[model samples]
Target: MMDVLIETRGLTRNYGEICALKPLDLRVNNGEWLSIMGHSGSGKSTLLNLLGGLDRPSDGFIRVGGEDLRVLSEDGMARYRREFVGIIFQQHHLIPYLTAVENIMMAQYFHSVPDEAEARTALERVGLGHRLKNRPGELSGGEQQRVCIARAIINSPRLLLGDEPTGNLDHGSTRVVMELLSELRAEEQFTIIMVTHNHEVAAWGDRTIYLDDGVMVREELKGD
Candidate 1:
């Protein structure tokens, strides 16, 4: 059996009278790839935010690596995110002034001492060896996103979370990014959970869970 890496029970998030997440229950095992799908207001992002400790749940439990997120303080959550969770968004969010190499190194610097050599290796792994010195403004959208991926994994996170990673890219770039994500996940063996609206894109995941109005509606497993 696969080892469970993420677990949630009755997880919920609320904003005033609006309930963004309604007691969601989910489990993702280590090295597994999961996609989340839902309508615009389906609370998919909210779910991702809660799992990533970007937001707190109003009720229920969230356990990753045997640590309950609810019990963590602000600093604790920041430490958790730095050490255990890697996050990506449709926006590359790269520093405009920094080169790809520098962007990757920034992560290392914040968490601890920076390793320039390791940062370069990470960019090379993402097939950006030739663009290591290129700043975000100089690189194409796809290249910038690759740099983001390299930065995300530089710390060797145990879980990778993405929100609309390909939402703004063209079809070709979407495929390119997805392929890179798959390759890296396999090489690193981190659990991945992506939130996307495109069914075709969601199909790339090993399993997919559908959401509606903050509730888990269904799940589909495509593993053979």
Candidate 2:
């Protein structure tokens, strides 16, 4: 039997009077790679935030791994983000002064305790073993993103969320990042929900859903 890791019903989100996401339902199976694609102002990031528990829905239900997100308190949501979700954004968001390994260790510091050994392992897993001591300013865009990936997986989260993770990368860099993510997902068995405007990036996932004006207009199976 297939395991359902995330489910939403009539999910909606609004900012002031603007509806960012309309009433919709979504289901994501365990370990599935689901991509969300849309043009600007199409609610792609809003949906990703809601799923990551970084933002709450204005109405309806959202459940991940059997936990209903709507009912979580602020602290509860923080805990959920720390323990269950790992996120990567278009911006590296690294401390300019911190070394690659330190940046990853910082993520660990928030989750529980910072462990240098584990942080090093995470960086190594992302193929950054040789660049551990380099600060964000010293690394290339792709290398900086690799550090972010290491930091994201350092917590061993059950779900990974990416908001235009490869948006700033060149074609070669994007390929490297996506390939690394695929390998990491296979080893960790985590579900991935990524938002991207690029069709090539969306095609990396098993399925892609397209949103328009806050509504899901259509979806396509990867190989169909």
Candidate 3:
């Protein structure tokens, strides 16, 4: 059995005539945090999507927590997406009508039976207990993003995948969110792969990878 939590070999992705990603090799150990940085159309998002199972790779081996995503069926992949990978989109995709807790509850419904108690606890974990009753429109941007994060982790996923989670926030809020992400990652012991263009945000990860033209060009490990 491989000790690596995530390992991809010769991963390739394409969209029509456009080559979204080239054959790439990447590895992430258990409980490690990895960040991918690149400019727009550089295949950063494509790599994250493939890792999270939102998009299938044209060619590659994708292993997450012992499961080979490349071989999973559609239903199996959906289950993996719900139970194994937690995703944080750049846009806080909370329902407009649902309150913070309700939004999390909806996520629960998709993955399994809704557990209000667990949903509430997830919101509280993100320091949004006070705003649980407030809808996304009523809460601040940071708070909404926190709710999104809470929803993402409600299932206790083994891998937390994020795509520019703090891209829309201010510096202070970005710091707060990044700090919260770092804290939760340490406490939950989950592997994290975040894609971002911000250097500061990438600095929060254990390793930073630079992608250009669908290829990984640079990587470095940071000491705490």
Residue 213 local lDDT, model 1:
96
- RMSD per candidate (Å) reads 1.2, 0.8, 1.6
How high is the CA lDDT of each candidate model?
Answer: 0.91, 0.95, 0.90
Best TM-score among the predictions, by candidate number: 2
Name the regions of candidate 2 deviating beyond 4 angstroms: none
What are the clash counts of all predictions, listed in order?
Answer: 0, 0, 0
User: Per-candidate TM vs. native?
Assistant: 0.97, 0.98, 0.96
Q: Encode model 3's per-residue lDDT on 96-152: one tens digit a residue.
A: 998899999998998989998899899998998888899999999899899999998
Q: Over 4 Å off in model 1, which ranges? A: none
- By lDDT, the best candidate is 2
Q: Which residues of candidate 3, in runs, are more than 4 Å off?
A: none
Candidate 2 residue-wise lDDT, 1-224, digit = tens: 88999999999999999999999899999999999999999999999999999999999999999999999999999999999999998998999989999999899999999999999999999999999999999999999999999999999999999999999999999999999999999999999999998899999999999999999999999898
- Sorted on TM-score, best first, the list reads 2, 1, 3
Clashing pairs in 3: none
What is the overall TM-score of model 2 with all chains considered together?
Answer: 0.98
